[model samples]
Target: MPFEHYKEVDLSSRNTLGLPSVSQYLGAFHSVSDLQHAFEFARNLSLPCFVMGGGSNILLPEYLPGLALLSSDRSIDIMGDEVTVGAGASWDNLVAETLKNGLFGLENLSSIPGTAGAAPIQNIGAYGVELARFVVSVEALDLQNGLAVTLTVDDCQFEYRDSLFKRHPERFVVTRLTLKLSTRFAPILAYQDLQRLPAQITESAEGLRRAIQSIRAKKLPDYRVFGNVGSFFKNPTLMKSVIQTLEQAQVLNSNTRSAQGKVSAAALIQAAELGDLSVGQAGISPKHHLVLENRGGATLTDVLTLAHLIQEKVERRFGVTLEIEPQQLTQLIHAPNPKG
Candidate 1:
């Protein structure tokens, strides 16, 4: 297929936030050959390419000046307990497929909204289980070399909601992901909500899947009905000394636990009584302090404004800075160092 056939596509449906935007150029690649051809087209035009998967984690501005590559291929293969999925494969689909095959490692990540290829970008995690634990390798198209390559888990540099893909956004476009899962029936019941689930001998992959879905349904707003990109900000990790100072001053909640002396950002936000704070169409979800939601027809500017306000309020109250989890498209507008 000619690359021109997929150029300048509207990206409203592609992104989860449903933000209306138009890419200067857009290309869809289903196979490795298609990806190579797309890259060639991009090179000829001298336009930077932005790779997008399910578009669950991004907030696109009203207008994008570069090419957007939408990965549409969705294929999966199972080798015993190991699963290899196409980059365009939905992450929630992988979780469901694993459970059907009696694999248990990904049950905790059920209902996450993104593609398998994007999981390692943020080391997508939930309920104490992270994608890094099961990732075997990642296949990506190296933009600089004009070839495809495979990266091991170590090469990805997995961290709390960060990885090599996120650190260097322009270097590679993920094409495929291989994950190592377990056929055994060991369920991870470590998170608070999971521990509260009723005990059952059938606590296998399927059981854990059901429990995770239930917990997410109760905690997170449905993206289909309500516009949201999951948790807006990451739970800030503070130094031990700073946590102690806040604890002594009664700024940190009593229920907050120490992560080697670091306090939870959720606890701190709730302690500061900013749980239901709102600014125009944006507000912090009263149900969960970590989530910032767009009530309706909210623009990217509104979201960023509320986020900055929340960060400033938190920092002024506790002297700890909060980092946003989702990728921001308009960081240039807020040029001041957020740490300030």
Candidate 2:
């Protein structure tokens, strides 16, 4: 084996929500050689395998039930406006580094809590900026054959808030990310909140990042402080006519449009009057309705129940379904909850 493996590894602290989870087998791999060896080890045991990144966007099961792969490489290389980042490297830190290196374009994505691997996996976006815009190529391994592959940006098939990597999690494990950034500063202040920034702040990259970070600080609770996924439900994007009907019914407000044809998920959740609601120890975040928090010692069951209740209420009120944003480890997609 290219690297040693551990059994029954504790994963509570590995995830942002601090859920108590354990993996049947865990291996830290530095290169493709190590990844292949780990996969072979899992194959010998007839178990499944998955790439585990910063764990910020996943709801882990109590037990992972298979091989949990961890990327140990954390290198970041910069040449002019191009950068090559190890998958395990911090996404926020990468943004910061690029800004310090005199590169622009990632300022609006400041403070997103996840690793580089998770960025493309989620096609992370904030304040009108999506990670897909800067991605040139992604280096990954085809898990089935353990073959190294570099996928062009088009091969990624990035969408509103999704990517092929997310849809085909079982097929690939991201190893590195290559981005082509810009030397010129072209700030994207299209989002309403960003447009409110003082002209002086918009003139500099760090100032723009500070403004975005400040807005996030007010909207989301720090995961370290209160165990939670930043955004629990993705905004329901529909045809403008569909949302207009909901608006006529007094379900969503005209100001709630975050993007064209996308009504705010937080608005829908609030319309259900669920901001003050809680199920057991899991509660809808009072600060932002889209955030679900573990008040204290909350189980996955508690969170799911609370989320289901919100979904049902919103669906009944507006005839629109709310989709959970964080990936579910137990079931990738939500199945209908009969009781709801």
Candidate 3:
């Protein structure tokens, strides 16, 4: 069956930042067949395909004149300690479901937004746990050749906030994720926030999940209220010599370190005193320096302006460049041709 496609789809409500945007064409990939059908449509029209996840980690432009795809293959199957989930499956839902079924590893990543397929791309980590540690393999379609292939953890080349998929956005689409979880509850409470929790909160798998969720709730803005994409910048990881250089320059603290002993991006922004900075409706989140909030009625330019300001100020002060965590539409996909 041919895939059904739509045109001029409104995407303002699709992204977490609530930027007003529109896609020239839109479709869903229910299965591999659907994927081929959608690509055929785009191929015939000479339009590039852009995949949209839960809309949690993307920045959309005002108009996208190509095909915008959303994965709808929300399939989940559990066999022993291995769990397989479709690309469209909600990440939080997967975490909750696995925990309910006695799987214990994803408890630390409790409330992360976006889909399961998007998890491996970023090697999403939180509370001392990384998705790469649990990922058995990633079932993806190599768009460059239109073939399905399963990528091993090594093939993924997992790094802090980056992976092969992330590096080459147009090459592959994650169709499914296979994770090897554990029945035994091994709680990881090494993060600074988790460290503050009492013993009871960290005693059980569920307890740790709820505690982490609560902590995130207090720090992160409700997208419904103030649109945001969690942390907007990745923490900067540097070599020991770089750290010493920064410390000597007074741009970094000798003690304030983040995961993998990297300097915290949030700390750098806070030290730059960018909390009160804003461009129109876009502002630096006072609650968390790493988050850039879209106060309703904000445009993409507003957000970009504010982000640029933060980057400029932080870099001016710390001599460290803060990399944007979320993928921008322009960066992720080929520019859509208005002529088409």
As a whole number from 0 to 100, the lDDT of residue 115 in candidate 3 is 91
Which runs of model 1 end up more than 4 angstroms from their true locations? 253-255, 329-340
Which regions of candidate 3 are displaced past 4 Å?
241-255, 334-340
Ranking by lDDT: 3, 2, 1
Candidate 3 has a TM-score of 0.94
The weakest ten consecutive residues by lDDT in model 2 span 331-340
For candidate 3, what's the RMSD? 2.9
Give Cα distance to truth, residue 253, candidate 2, Å. Answer: 2.8
lDDT of 2 at 130: 97
In the range 99-197, model 2's lDDT, one tens digit per residue, is 999999999999999898889988999998999999999998875555799999999999877999888876778889999999999999988888888
Tens-place lDDT digits, model 3, residues 158-204: 99889999998978888998999999998888787888899988889
Every model's TM-score: 0.91, 0.95, 0.94
Rank candidates by TM-score, best first. Answer: 2, 3, 1
